[model samples]
Target: MASPVLLCVGLSHREVPIAVREQVAVSADDLPEKLRRLKAIPGVREAFLVSTCNRLEIFSVADSRTVADDLLREVGPAGAPHAVVRSDDDALTHLFRVAASLDSMVVGEAQILGQIKDAHETAKLHGAAGAYFARLMAKAQSAAKRVRTETQIARGAVSVASVAVQLARKVLGNLAGRTVLLVGAGEMAQLAARELHQSSASELLVANRSSARAEEIAREVAGVAVNLAELPALLERADVVLCSTGAREPVVTHEMMVRALKARRYRPAFLIDLALPRNVEPSVNELENVYVYDMDDLERVAAGNRELREQEVARAEEIVREELAALRKADRERSAVPVLARLREHAHGVAKSEVERTLAQLAALDEKQKKAVQAMASAIVNKLLHGPTSRLREEQGGPLAEAAAELFGLAEGPGADPVANPVANPPEGEAADVLPISGRK
Candidate 1:
């Protein structure tokens, strides 16, 4: 029988919009049921689903190539139009790239590795994954680790929220005892608040027009919720200001910052304006100790970091290729195992049968003599088979194993007659000529 194919079928950011991706996306709570359903599909021997913000992929070991069609059908209506399919080596290579984060929306982001691990574990827990996925995941993780450690691909911040944090650190030295003022409770502001929270900021003040929204974000980041009316007071105390409000005009005006800067005795303050309409005034940057960064500035930093990461991608890809070659070689050697076992069993059986026949004819001999003859036959068989077995293993045993079975008249599996043909159990007078040690055909 042909070995099962490794198949990957999915819709990623490259092929579809977020709307289409969301339609097929599986949540963590729903993964078990999704995996169970996939395992039930015909020809799908083993499988796992990787669902994230950017992609929804199904990896499977399948009996037939048509399993790709089945997987697409299962991913809902969006799958057939946008899904890309890869089989065998290409599929495995794609998996390795995904685990290494090379295929992420923001390349070199580390989240995809953990996401893949979680998906694999979920599949295994639900019995949707078997030996094939276990090995594939292990190799993929190893390759990802190598790519991370051996290259500089994951060295910098690629997201706007993270870049804001980096810029804050660059200007403020360290956030250890610094207070951060979050000027909005919108999604962008919330993300910035979370990033600053993780940086060990001493205090985070959340200010928003809606008191309830401000309090909600404040509670999430372990901070105090201040009224938007207290912006001037909050600015004076804050070392960093992150503004992402929905106001039409500048919330942090030049005059407001000037008064706040004087009250604070001109201490350096880093301001990040993430709002689309510019929450902070452009002229506020003219203040000697005040640094203002708008969305354009953050995007520039992110773009620069992305370029640096792109430069490291070639090296990361080299590591992945090395790992892939090693895995393929290991798989080939593993495939030789059963064939080698069957070949040795057939040889040992032939040797034992011949020894038993000779011993019965020499019944006059002592027990010790009969035992020694049997030992001699076993020793000869081992010595004669050793060279062929060694060569078969070196050559990965595929074609050579089939040839060995045919040459020795040996069956493919156990419980078959060892001497099933004339070549192996030659008729009486022909026995001497069969497999002669001397070159006398």
Candidate 2:
């Protein structure tokens, strides 16, 4: 009966440098291994990790603060300054905010929702998700959808691709004559290619596993289609490579790119990898005269969307606050369940013992009379406990109820049960910063 407590530790693009985030980036392929390592820690009943270019986060359910600390230590930098540690309500609220894009660099971009869903599924596939985390993620998803539907938060032209193109223009002086090599041909890649094309990139080349699909996208975008085999050669020719393939393995490995670099004789190339599994290898980032960026690096470009999304900030905040209050109320109501259950158990124990003692003392009575006496005792017990039971159910989180619980030994003391009455009497020391969950019930 260990109380379930959630822990969230994360580093985002806003907080850390791209180099740091990339170093700590848990690729989708490595998630299961990371989760296994996390669950092996002391008191960690369950664990999950969600890592994208914009954010890298670990969510876990544990019985002790030490477990959460271990999770942070494992996921965070040895001396990282930017990582945020959240527990309890704060963890829940942060997750909902992230899912809703309120915590994203681009406030209402739809990409984070898909990323969150993918992460959640990854956790489930690895057996890291249990009842508590599953319930929480479901609520977070629903809350995000509600926020999008009920508010104007998602309205307008906002996306990571547009932002990236805008940022590229800022860096490259002009995008008009740039040669853009489009890799992967996925939704994000298509979007980036479209944005670059619209921005007047002089030449566009689409290279993907499926030549036909690449051709289709290229034809539609008025670009040239090249076979995936030509990627290395194409790498030498393009000024910018926008890669967003679905391959779990890196399509552009460091060795492959090293040859391409040698072939091109060290020309500067901007490589943008937008795949979740990461189409480009991490080591390719080390290539001199090459600028490598992933989804996490896009945060710089996406940051501008924050200003546009600010127009709907008030409405979104109101929705979040209102939902948070309702969730808190429900959580408060649930806290009463344990107390009432304890009271019932105490009353039943007292009645059973007293009845047994009375029956022993009334040995001279006939069997029929004993049965009648037993019924009478049961009735008296029920009548005596009815008022207290009703009062206990109605007096949730009140001083009277807490006092009653203390006297009855219903509470296991501070930090022993996180889900008990956490918001009421938060634990001292390490558990003090735990926040309330602000998700929909």
The numbered model that scores best in TM-score is 2
lDDT of 1 by residue, 142-231 (tens): 999998898888876755578788888899887888999998855556777788878999899999899998898889878899999989
lDDT of 2 by residue, 1-441 (tens): 555666787777666665566567776667888888887888887777888766888888788655656776776563145677787767777788898889876678788889988887877877877766776677778778888998787875567777667656655658888899998866777887888988889999988788899889998878999888988889888878898876657888898888888888886778888775577888888889777777776775566666666758667777776776666566556666666777667777787788789889888999899888778877887888788778866765455556667888877643236543333333345444642222101
* Model 1 regions more than 4 Å off: 159-192, 196-307, 361-369, 393-441
RMSD of each: 13.9, 6.5
lDDT of 2 at 214: 87
Provide the clash count, candidate 2: 5
How accurate locally is residue 140 in candidate 2, as Cα lDDT from 0 to 100?
Answer: 75
Top model number, lDDT: 1
Q: TM-score of predicted model 1?
A: 0.64
